[model samples]
Target: MVREIMEEGLLTSRYQLPPNETKPTSNGADGDGLTDNLNMPSQPAASSLTLVLVFCTFVAVCGSFSYGCSLGYSSPAETGIMEDLDLSLAEYSVFGSIITIGGMVGAILSGKIADLIGRKRAMWFSDVLCTVGWLAIAFAKNALWLDIGRLLIGLGVSIFCYVVPVYIAEIAPKSYRGSFASSNQLMTSSGFAIMFFVGTFISWRTLTMIGAIPCVVQIIGLFFIPESPRWLAKCGREKEFEASLKRLRGENSDISEEAAEIRDYIATLEQQTEASFLELFQRRYANALIVGVGLMLLQQLGGNSAVVYYTSRIFKESGISGSLGLQVLAVLQVPAATIGLLLMDRSGRRPLLLVSASGLCFSYFLQGLAFCFKELPNLKALTPPLALSSTLIAATAFTIGLGGIPWIIMSEIFPINVKAQAGSLVTLVNWSTAWIMTYSFNFMMDWSLAGTFFFFSGISGLTVLFVAKLVPETKERTLEEIQASITHFM
Candidate 1:
């Protein structure tokens, strides 16, 4: 029904490149679309060779991994914490659901903080918050402490989710930016998987402590990495911007052309009047906003959060051992993330999203079917395998596209003038929708397990149409060109 609603509006116009615009290809070196202009001669762009760029991205995504730890923690730790603390199901649910509330707050302020101090500083501040949150969790004596700690960690990771990807996109050379920016989600998946696996063996308190380690490592690592050059330029710190850009590009490579292009772009943006929320409503900004916010809405509403948040519970209900089920998921997500990283640049975003969302629709329908069959004595034998396959397929399908592309597209499509505002709005909606889904899933399942999944399946089905009709191919385009193409349609 949601698919039908969206199809009526979006299906009429197939996505087409602007008539005068030439589509950029990755056929040549420097093909990730960092050219001075479409008409300009091709310049040298090294392919993922700069150690500083690599290291910086690695450091930034440590925060992302920590963010994932916060997300996956509640699922495996749920049983242990409830037993150890002697908490009610209601209390534990509060502990689990409060993170998204914190996340909403963080999303609103992430852009301002990143712009105020710098990306590294914003990350450092987030790490400190996460450290405090984890310590609070580790030492909690009561339910209040747990909720507060969880909320703190949630807030920190909310900032990490927005700032980390944006930082990587700003600093990374266009050649492998897609793959590098994707490392944010890669580490996040790894974090969730590792936490679940480790939680199977360790206590909840010990897992909280383990979560702090990455933040500490990121804090130390941040000192060595240069600030984002685009940010520096945005701040009018011309010398620092040059130094940072050169550092990221490597000293031997020619940075002059790219530097000039960035400076010119920044200069043009600075000359424009400041953009407010009202300006975002202008006809020119319509397509970018729709695609950005629309993808985020689909990602969260499709039930990724509920699945991760209740993986162990779902498995247990299906007559599988929750511990072993979590272990399977621990092993499953990493390979899926690797596949996504490999295909991010190669296959492009739109095709992968369509495929992933279609798979999710099928997987969730299968899950609903499994639950439906559980009531029939004759088909009871099929429930376990069907449930297991559905879970694994859903996780894999989510990681392949919907898990990361929304954030990637959020960073790519918006022009610098509106990026902060647009990013915050998208991030807020993503977390808000996530909160509603995660908080409601348990009750919905109690009402009817099959109904809950059928709802998610419907949302997943709508996502395929959303991408096909609305999302532009952002594969190898420069950030400038991407904005241009999006605004062209508007």
Candidate 2:
């Protein structure tokens, strides 16, 4: 009976209901100029693909841009901060890795915050946190101050990890949802690329101040956008729900069918007992939890974050111009992310995941081989170019799929009822593993560069297997349909 109700809810939400079914409306008095329709088909408004969506998505991803800034800040500032503060490698490492500690704590609470407040308010809260963090970093006079600032920024980033993609997913029309959701990654990569490019010309203090710009932009922009229609419906705010849905779909678009479908799904969800954290362990949610959390593990453990965070040092150690290498990374990151955004909906999720994981394996393998050749005196000259090429390849390949798809999948797979808990759990795993990998990366590099890349290469290979065997194709599916299908598969 439960499964049957779920399917009913999904089908209604994903498709137009029959003309005979009257939609839930405020007694023909909706001030948004919507009319009662007894003989109409439920379809997206002719203007469903509107400028408002584009603008709103852009605004929401400003938070993602801030997140990228926070991540990239330590890389460029590493030398300056260490020199100016007379810090050791250990101190610098602590400064660089402490963000993930904050990220872990924030991830654990991210969903609860989003659910407790609304999506827009959560973003507002995040922007405020990040702004303060950047300010703290900008004026820090000691190592203690720097570490404290980085931790606060990390907390903001943890919220970004969950909310940005989820916000984009909720607001976008199904026709363009994948591409729009891909924008979160694009903005994030742009953030990293921007810092990398701009840091070349600016002081570390100036760059930290620049980091606060996006937070302000996002905070102000949040006031102009509509809250998530889905979120409003879930909260039982019927009038606001209708208004938000109408605003997204357009004034004249027939939203009755879509509204009815959403209300039905919410109604079905309401019939079930409210779930607790422990309830997530049930077999019903296992596939989603596994896929969501598993991809996060694979993404972080594959060494992308560590590589991104420590690229300059890696290049210096390999006898390449660290500055030149960072420049090349800055140039390539956005184009790669843009390509992924364009391809997100056109190519299915599974294919992209497989290709991304495969490319990462090959790139890491090549880097490992380069480090191996470094030990051979005759082949020492080849190591620099090989390492440089491999870094570029890895950066490009990572952005192409793994960078964006995991979050997209996370936003899509879970049912509405368990979305908060599921998102938080997956996000927590992602950050915790990220923290462990990032914190340990330097030590691992010290142990053996060849071993480090080889280990990452192995993990990348495992990711390919995991995606092929377990991950589902979510292209073109409504959120309801995606969750229902995953449940059936499990």
Candidate 3:
């Protein structure tokens, strides 16, 4: 669930460009033209004007919207696509799940891609891939082309799922970081909701093309948004970093304290031996590593992907009309995302996760029972509304916490030096498990729909324990402070 929270102190500011503000002469330290005249103020920063921060977040979340469309597209598209291509259930299942396979590859490369090319460039590259993927799907006449297109979309979405949140986390102030970063999931919900509604009326190919429009918007937007200042500083481009940070903070806001804090932290990271992907498993890093990967694993295994991708099929297979349920879900997602956004910083991560996982357990149990009821005498009448209610509850619970908070915590807990390694591994595990479940979901449903849901319910129950024991509250803390508290128990 996502809501648009107006960030404090920025919405009503008298936004105006300075008369003397000149374009930076170069990409060096003066690129933003702030270095020579920038004052190193000793006082703590009061507040930042966030128009640019808001705009940059909007651009980044365009990728997130595309990601959501890719996930939500399969359900409404499934029936039409099968008829168009004469696809077998197995073939269509491959088409549905192929994105996760691509996601795995992209996850492996996402951190490195962000690190090498910079966050802004990585998003731009992913948008290009998604655009091509959508075009391929829009024109494909056969199953092979469909799978290839879906795979490309998956590859791109995986990178987006990793980079967008990380980029937002890096650029946002600690106070606003939770809500701003959570906006990534908010746009995702919007995309998924729109696709579910539109696909009901349009051809699958047309729907695929519609998905590409966001990609185009994001690609053009990349030129206007600044790269993550922390990333620029990581690369030792101090001038550009200051310039970028100053722009994000607003024309008049002082950038000195925050800039120095970032520099000091990055400097401290350079003193340690940076861990490779495998080295991330070391005991010293175990707390952060387990929390990151464990949450990702549980997030997928809880059946969000499989359920979302096949919602229509699930309803149809139960001999109920899914359109009403789908519509309700689309409507329900708004408040759900809103609730999550509103409570993100206020409720803190741990409580929300615990409550969400607990709700998921109950919702899935209802789903299993709803499926099970059809088999019993005189109970077939109850399946429709019961099934629909379970789905809405499950979705609301997932969105409220488990859906996006793992990502928020993932971005916060890792030090920049190992963020790439840790992020790649975590993202890969997420996609890998997603692949296993999504690819097998149809077959599993055939095996026993009730059984499949019960299994997912049990997994969610375990997730409750996992969060209660391991996941830490990361509210209201700087990234540096969060990482230290996570890994420095020694």
Candidate 4:
């Protein structure tokens, strides 16, 4: 429903910022065991954007590309599937919405799977499931087989939606971390765009095979990538942790400062009790939890998911050619995502999110007006162009910020002791809300086309305030600085 980009990852690294933008004071540990608080002298930041970091990120985001393929595949293949299988509207709706159910299931299991199996392994496993799912769809003759494939694909993608971003964060060079992280959307945009372009020329079955390629790519790519260093640190694999960090940082680089910081911080985390799901609600965690979960809630409620899954319908309803409109939408994603990559750290998360959300509000308002005009006897004749224009603006806004920043915020905000628990909670909320929004969208449109858009506009307007009030400016700060500010170990 997020169209693979909905309510998902965002941010940049320290690469583009000036050397002088550093904090005046150390944000180390509390009187607690956290060492960063001790004013420990900083080491030479590895300013190098090494090939290793880039390759690992590329591998991780192959999963993201596959995810986009999965999201985009549905729209292109929909007409063909319904015709071939003779699915009733209700049956097809299940195929359409079943991904969210699997996503919810994956969300529930994702944090635990990644934490238990290691990020790289989790990704490998997810790709396998996706590959199998695609194969099932490619060969399926009945609705049951199609649903099973779709369900498996959704389960796998929801995991990618979590691990790929987290994996990128862990390996990314702090300098351009946000930029590097933003590449997830870039590849996703690429996959989505490619699917739309090629689907017109290929059979639905052939499309399924194309969608499976990235899954295989990621599976192969995972072999070359190192396990997340933080994960290794968490697992007490000192040698492997250092090795992974060293590989990520570069072979010749001095890993001592970074290594010690990670070790000490993890040690600090080690002293804290691992929080259970219920324990995540404690007052100390209240702020971080609110930011993590609130962003996810508002992100979907803003109607990105609805607009995405039904864009073609929206176009057709406005009397535009749905195929032409979808192609146009496909054309817009890459450049928009590219703009997001360039701007993420330069603008900072809060500013970009504000601009993006505000842009969406404005766009959705325009769309509401378009629908309102459609209701007018005379003005109705001219509403199609307006609806198309407004939809494009909304899509662009979504790609740039609201689409991904919440995830960056989520990954950065949670303390290590409860990150897994927090991740499960945050991811679960995201997919669950997505399902609700996706499910209700058509009904809302039926009730009132103009009203439906106005409702979306209102939610997006509220999102602006929510982000402004609660979302922190993560920028180039270390994860320690972010968490410490929220939890205030003092």
- The TM-scores of all predictions, comma-separated, are 0.92, 0.92, 0.90, 0.91
**What overall lDDT goes with each candidate model?**
0.85, 0.84, 0.84, 0.81
List the candidate numbers ranked by TM-score, top first. Answer: 1, 2, 4, 3
Q: Tens-digit lDDT track for model 3 on 1-490?
A: 0111121111111121355764334453113321222222222535564889999999999999999899889988888999988999889888888999999999999999999999999998899899999999999989899988999999999999889999999998877788898888788888998888888888888899889999999999999999999999999999999999999988788888889878877776676565577767665568888899999999999999999999988888667677766777888776888889898877778888999999999999998998899898799878878888888899999988998899888898888888998889999999999998887787889899899999999999999999988887776666765665564332
Q: Which residue segments of model 2 deviate by more than 4 Å? A: 1-47
Q: Pick the candidate with the highest TM-score.
A: 1
User: Per-residue lDDT for 1-490 in model 2, tens only?
Assistant: 5764564444334433475776565332121111222212333534277778889999999988998888777788888888888999889989899999999999988998998898999999888888888888899998898888889898988998898888888877666888999888899999999888888778899999889999999889999999998899999999999999888777877888878867876776777677788887776788888899999999999998898889888998888887788889899999999999898888767788888999999999999999999999999999999998998889988998999899999999887778889889999999899888998898899999999999999999999999988888776656765665675453
Query: Candidate 4, residue 213: CA error in Å?
Result: 0.6
How many clashes does each candidate structure show, in the order listed? Answer: 0, 0, 6, 20
Worst 10 residues of 4 by lDDT: 7-16
Model 3 regions lying over 4 Å from their true place: 1-45, 488-490
| Alpha-carbon shift of residue 481 in model 3 (angstroms) | 0.4
Tell me which residue pairs clash in candidate 2: none
